[model samples]
Target: MTSGDVSLETVTAAKAGDRKALEDVLAGLQDRIYSLAMRVLVNPDDAGEATQEILIQILTKLSTFRGESALSTWAYQIAVRHILNARKLRDRDLGLTFEMFATDLETGLVADPPAAPDQALLLNELRISCTMAMLLCLTLELRLAYVLGDVFEMDHAEASRILELTPAAYRKRLSRARAEVIAFTSQHCGLVSNQAKCSCPRRLPAALKSGRIRSGSYPNSAGASVDYAAAKQQIASVVDDLKTFKLQQAVPGQMCPEDIRGRLTRMLSHPL
Candidate 1:
């Protein structure tokens, strides 16, 4: 749910110990929290764990939420802070560098790739997985800058506030992130340039054989069928490099599994 969907009355009630209102408040923010975490962390398991911890932090601090900013902004600020510190506290590392990722993209590419299989959304899986994987190459700070500033299309002021940076500082970080991403994609990704060696179709076979994507098991498929060429053409039609990355925002938000979600709510009652 969007921030606009969460009412001020609900926030007030939640802050005042209304259980139902607390649930509503957290519910409105969960998907957004998960989405941001997924983009920054690039692992479903990591994002899920992060979402739970972030939500719990929000819950504990709900009373202090003075409402000076929008609830979504407050929530996002909390999420960003938590994720940035989480790596240090937990010793978590994805260990991806741009040079390594560039090599990975070029590896196992099919020069004359066979036709994309039409069975249950393999192409979409490959497309989404590759795009998400690309973000892993960036440092967490830059990745968050790109996800908040570009993928979500958040306003500069709002994004800066969430990132807790001055507007100029935020812009500089985003510029660096945008430049790094655009430079890599422009030279390598077929969606940004036809001359690029790696297209989704060319990568599909290696992805399947490597067990990166199993056939018909993608949990978040959006369409009955995906036209690889059409999608590439549509994304490539945009002339701007930064704008081209925006088109890749089709990666669906990750959600917590039901059992984990239920456990999150139970935290309120159990106080763990």
Candidate 2:
């Protein structure tokens, strides 16, 4: 049968509460759902639990689906809600920022004469752990916005519909999510570090020279070398503008920590 025929069959069987059909549907979509969950939860254990919960929810709610949207869309919506609720239950501090999760997985990967076996193993584990952690820091709304837009490559309108947000609101959330990812990358991945000479705009050439960043290649769950040159440039421009503004407000000699904190708060409060 064609793909559509198969999907229809699965839907019918799923509605009829066929356990094998439910299992088939879950198996078919497991990787996509798992990857999205991992990206949002940033923790493999949490992602796995969320994935299981999502499958269970899909099975239970399959009959309620009224054909208002495609089966995939309905599945995505359920997964998104499951992940969001899981995050809420775990993290009481809504102020939890994304910076805490972005670790430098590429560290020591380019050591001289190649890394020793243990060092190599450690680096590999770090990459996997860091990617999982990064997914956990994102807010539910931002995570859904990113997964649908970036991973699925859905257009803004389509993403908005899946997310149940206005086009403008979806765009705004997407922008914020992108910014958070950029900032988290810069802070955690040593994307802007003086030690490796990998700071933002300058890191692209360095990363290529060291063979740390690959183009058009996808890495499995562990981590992939990303083309962050453009993202870095954009984020760097924002950082530079902020730095310039801060310098402009400086009164030369006396600086108070509280005053600096207040200024930083104000800067962050401003829209990008």
Residue pairs with backbone overlap in model 2: 40-135, 41-135, 41-136, 42-132, 42-133, 42-135, 42-136
lDDT of each: 0.78, 0.52
Model 2 worst lDDT run, 10 consecutive residues: 247-256
Give candidate 2 regions above 4 Å deviation.
1-6, 92-114, 118-124, 135-137, 184-272
Candidate 1 lDDT, tens digit per residue, 117-226?
56327777777777788888888888888999889889899999998899999999999998988888888887777788887778878888888878867754444244
- Assess the local accuracy of residue 177 in candidate 1 as a C-alpha lDDT between 0 and 100: 91
Could you estimate the TM-score for every candidate? Answer: 0.91, 0.59
Model 2's TM-score against the true structure: 0.59
Report residue 142 deviation for candidate 2 (angstroms).
1.9
Best by lDDT: 1
- Count clashing residue pairs per candidate: 0, 7
Backbone clashes counted, model 2: 7
Worst 10-residue lDDT window for candidate 1 reads 220-229
Can you write out model 2's per-residue Cα lDDT over 1-272, one digit (the tens) per residue?
32222376777776786656665665555556666665566444555666666766766677787666666677777887676666554574244555433223333333333333343333333333333345446776786787677556678876787787899999999888767765555444543333432232222333334554443332331233322333234334555224222211111111112332233334333321
Candidate 1, overall lDDT?
Answer: 0.78
